[model samples]
Target: MNFLLHCCPVHHVMVLLFTTMVAMEFGQGCTQITTCVPGQPMINCSVVTHDSNSDPPIQITSYVLENIPPNSVIYCLNDSAFFDTPGTVTYAASSDFTINDAINAVLLIRSPNREADDQITGRVTAFDTPDQSEANLQVIIIDVNEFPPEFIAPDVLQHSLRFTEGERPTNSLVGRIQTSDVDIEDSESTVSFRIKGNGGDEFNVTRMTVGPISFSNLLYTYDSPLDRERIAFYQLTIVAVDSISPVMTSNPSLQVNITIDDINDNAPQFMGDHMFFIPEGLEEGVFVGNVSASDPDAGENATITYSIASSTFDREFTIDSTSGILRTSSFYKDLRFADNMRRLTVEVMAEDNGVVPLNNRSVFTVVVQRPVRFTNNIYMFELVENNNPLVTVGNVSASSPDLVSFYYHIESPGSDKFTIDRNTGKITVQESLDRETSPMEMFIIAAVYSNHSDLSSTAIVRIIVIDVNDNSP
Candidate 1:
């Protein structure tokens, strides 16, 4: 029985050995372990030292394709599983975007990503050829600031500053974003940010530095409000570039709008088409017209002034300033034997207070009118010294060129003014006269002699009143 027990023990040992060897073919550390980082050589280690229960834990680190070309076959001894790999492992990023295929097959970097602290995690499937896959490794690649600095939150960029003629944003922080690849924190992975948008007057990158920031330049300065009073607003673009080129993800240059504060720059000016009107029989001093203009500038620049450019009217016409009025400057006889004229051509000017001193001027024309006059006085005697008067008196005689040679009919002016004998041409006063109201006056009118036109030389006449004294002074 003791011998039987020994044989059983030997069989049990053989069974245990077989089971351990079989298990070692598939588990960690029985044969070789491949460290994912730094391309460490594959090594064979005893299975007992496998870290199945380590504390902080060791995970498969970021692995890049070794010296092999893309689509080249590689036999892998990872932990204990043998995986034959072909084709390149792709580093998938966010939705719909990825590192280029060429970058995928080798160690290449992604531009500035939208965030930091993210892992370059992706699926690495082993394929026998570029077109086929059998086993897959969910590889996790650590991330650092492989991407340059950029603005991200809000998906918007903003800046504020006092604006001048050439003013713009400078060293102020626009914003910050994350990266695509993570290297050791101390490595050159901390990419720097900069600007190319400031383009000075030509829209050069006027103000730029190697970091994320916000600021303004005094290149353009203004002591007063902007010329918005002259022109209203402006649009500008700002640019941002990076220290690391491939690490290009940055806020695109944003457009900024600036509104100019208004200040007066123009003055009121008058249009050229001005006209004048002089009332019929207008008094010499009566005002006839007014003037006006417009200003393109504001405030004090817009104020206006009025004056007589050219007034044909005399002192009789006057103008009121604020009301744009024209009144009689000095009253004058509206009635005159001679024509009264108020016609005039004149010019006026409006000026503005700008550095260049701008001004507006215009011309206007005025019209004048005249009146009629009459002559007075009449005399008479049996025989006077060749004297003629406008009216006839009691015993005196006077005649018109058509009426006198002998007589006249009351149907004509000469007959209406004097009663006359046709044969003797002796005329007498037909109506009483008042010197003040209806003073004796002479009027030369053509008179007809024969039934037809028998014209004669214009003649003279005289009329004397017997002084019945019907008129009162």
Candidate 2:
């Protein structure tokens, strides 16, 4: 029995030694370790040591791909595992690393976390080559603190905000402040916001927390009514704090300046008393004195538009909307027959273009003086015989600014071939003219007001009747 036990123990030892040799051959073929960034694709097999003298966190570290064997295919073992990558990242496996390609490929690693799996495990297998072997790959992932939270659209740094006074409602959204932490998305890399300055009570700011993979945004709202006259602007400081405990103190802060926009609270006012003098029979489109006023508001709120609110004469004058220039649009008429002081009153109003408009009205008394005698006296015309005889020949235009209405008549010795209208002074052919009878005709046309005898003017109208083929020769 003792001899049998010895033989059995020897056989068992042989079996154990054979198993150990096979395991060593499989796992220990070539256990090569190389460091690389997480999202980065190429595996640098070169032996490189960190330099404590230079800046520690550098973007790229050199890798010697020439040491890797030929006909070798690289395999990433963590295909099914999840890992953190900064920004949008992609991976590629290549046999030969060129100088340009290696530099570009190194940037794709994104923000790799050193605390996590800094080095990835992979396998390099060779085919159809002597010393064909399977080797272990160790890739070190490099961590870079390159990303900081940034303000999104409506960059608070570049833009200024405005709110109308007494018009904005409470809790109204004034502006939105947003920030993003792009690199190494994790609990330690999260960002938060807070407002940390004066005027905090005037406005309310709310922080909206986002997920680990997203960003943070803040909503700023007006909490009360603002009086621009009392306080026109507000200055506040905002700070962005990261989730990193000690690092939060080193984050960024922003100073915001908000302006309160003005509203139209005061009406336009006339400067002086109302009465002025203008002579009767003044020409149309004549510039009257300008009406001046002032406004307490700013920008367009101070702009005034002048209008003729009421006038004894209908549509007799026009006022400029911008320049406040008042001009006559029609001939001036005397009102002395009514037993008054020959005076005219017009109501002028001024309005401001503001968020809410304000207006003021003022009365203007214009004293009418005696008009000068009419000076325009002569008018001439020519008519074609074949033209529609009922159509008007030309109007006998005369200067009589003081007369509201006038009568026109041909004086004695005037030919009955043409007649003048009593009101419009328009002359028409009473009958078809025969140039053969009177080739040239002369008439004295008189324009006089029926009510006022002094307002009268006469013109010598010479008519040339051209001969046409109307007569059968």
Candidate 3:
């Protein structure tokens, strides 16, 4: 075995001074032993500081073996700690010394624990036949923050939230966003927050300073006003990024769901004008028309109940609660059936059921009139000449408030020449007549009996007869 110093000029001087001190302290008791052991002249190499969290089998530094003997071997001796530990640091080897035995052999050191920063010592030894020599190696572990920040809770927020429809106070805390980083000693492990996904701009996350600190109290606030009728819910993502260089690496993200609570903020309105014209004498409980309205709210806040809030004849009219159907009430029979037109004004109310109920009102105008024989007051027809006996010359139509039967007859110049059907008010020629002797004029009276008496209406007909040449006298 041979003792040799292999290093740069700087470390070479430190190794000599350190060796002299150790030798003087221990005197001849530390003999120049020609054997591989723990306390030996450490060929001072460079000060090696490696990054923690590096992969296994990381290189610390290398040493060189000078002037080796033939058929001799060089290897690492067991250190008290990491280097020779069974699983921590195994498989240590120096560049093959046998192949180039005459020249200096480079020593290469490696360990499998790449993420550890514990300061430990390592050793390497050389052997020649029965002789051996050993050297001490110095290694320093530097901590590095490589892992990103993560949410302390689930990737999705566990708490569901809700807010009213309005602007929130400035800097008002809506909720807390919690996070953590595993790197304790790293200054760059501080976590900052950002909101993303849809409606991200509606909220603001608290800012954090750059340094090692807990990010568990990151509170979020509402930045913009809310309208439940326009937008009901929001789905968003919260991202936590470390203050370290290159913000994207290992950044954590999570989803948060929020809903806007409803409010009865809108009023009801009628679809059109409320005026209506109905014939007189309609039966009780018959539907007249509908009054409709709507609300801009959601759920129970928009559900509306209706009522006939006021009317000139309250006892004669009614409205449905759910459907808003206007109808004649049971007391409609109590009203007088008069010959003149009557007018009634009604007000309908629509109300919503919410945390705070709201209401609206609308006016309805109803006109009632007696039944008439026809929409038009006057009716006339020209008679064609030489018609068959049963030929219908014309028809007289009528309208009524209620379904009622009518009778027909020829009033003025009642003659056997023409007749009217009692059921249909159709006038037909009873017999063929000569234009020379017939009066050429006639009238029809359409009548319906009320209280066993005839209530009549009238129409006219003129028979214009043409002479045939074959009938010349």
Rank the models by TM-score, top first: 3, 1, 2
What Cα-based lDDT does every candidate model obtain? 0.36, 0.52, 0.54
What TM-score number comes out for model 3?
0.48
The regions of model 3 sitting more than 4 angstroms off are 1-115, 118-148, 154-157, 162-171, 182-190, 208-227, 242-252, 263-277, 296-300, 330-343, 367-473
Q: Which candidate would rank higher by lDDT, 2 or 3? A: 3
lDDT of 3 by residue, 148-187 (tens): 6776656334556677887553355566566665543332
TM-score for every candidate vs. truth? 0.34, 0.31, 0.48
Return whichever of 1 and 2 wins on lDDT: 2
262-357 per-residue lDDT for model 2 (tens digits): 887778878964655455556777766677777777778888988889987756667887787777776453223342645677788889888788
Count clashes in each candidate, considering only residues at least 3 apart in sequence or on different chains: 63, 3, 2
lDDT winner between candidates 1 and 3: 3
| lDDT tens readout by residue for model 1, 199-285 | 324222233335854332223323333454433555555444443323444455445444544344455556644665443455455
Measured on C-alpha atoms, candidate 2 has an lDDT of: 0.52
TM-score of 1: 0.34
Off by over 4 Å in 1: 1-114, 118-207, 210-230, 234-257, 261-267, 283-287, 309-317, 323-328, 332-342, 349-361, 369-473
